[model samples]
Target: MVTFIEKGFLYGFILGLSLGFFIVPYKEVFPMGEGVTETTYLNLVDFIIPLIRVGVITAVIGGLVGFFFYRKKIRAYNNK
Candidate 1:
């Protein structure tokens, strides 16, 4: 069984990536929509980069919150 803190990080990483994991360039028309046409291309980012960035932020937060809640549960269990 995974610890609550670990599960927190895991769930957070998945949720964060699912939220905004893509970088899609928008089609931009410039110069009063007259001759300049900007081509929009889909940029494929390596899964590692966002995972690391997002994991560092949201996962840590989740782990801390999980730790806090877990401690509360433990205390309740012990008192019972």
Candidate 2:
């Protein structure tokens, strides 16, 4: 159970960091001629912060799921 939780956390952290890398290149582009000036910029901090937050949430959920499955398996084994 502890191992599952640790693995879940590691996986989640890696996935989140990779996603952040992908998001780093994102740029919001505003088209001109719509009564608005064209603008493009990357908000690295904003994007990364959310990715980290989601990653942590995912890690917790994954850990809980692993724990639940482990418990279920143990129960089934004992019943047999």
Candidate 3:
């Protein structure tokens, strides 16, 4: 049980951190607004802040999902 939760958090953290590379702030993932006509590069703080924010959010979500998914297995193991 503990191991499963730990693994979930660990994997989630890693996955979230890596996601930063693919996703960024105001990325217009589901764009329905006007198209961009300009471009600009992000500074260190600008880029990093989003990464950290996304990382933490994803990590928590990942941990929770893992816990729920493995809850049954954990109970079964304890019964044994």
Best by TM-score: 3
By lDDT rank, best first, the candidates go 3, 2, 1
Q: On residues 1-80, what C-alpha lDDT tens digit does candidate 3 reach at each position?
A: 57777788888888988987788763323434597354456677888888988888888888888888798777888899
Kindly list the per-residue Cα lDDT of model 1 for residues 1-80, writing each as its tens digit.
14999988887777666653553222334454757666654334555565567656877887887888899898999998
Off by over 4 Å in 2: 19-25, 34-39
RMSD of each: 4.0, 3.2, 5.0
Sort all candidates by TM-score, best to worst.
3, 2, 1
Candidate 2 Cα lDDT to native: 0.73
> Using lDDT as the measure, which candidate wins?
3
lDDT (Cα) of model 3: 0.78
Candidate 2 to truth, TM: 0.67
Where is the poorest 10-residue window by lDDT in model 3?
A: 24-33
> What's the lDDT of the predicted structure labeled candidate 1?
0.67
Q: Tell me the tens digit of each residue's lDDT in model 2 across 1-80.
A: 78877877777677766765665555676768768777676577867677787677767777777788788888999999
List candidate 1 segments past 4 Å from native.
22-37, 46-51
TM-score of 1: 0.62
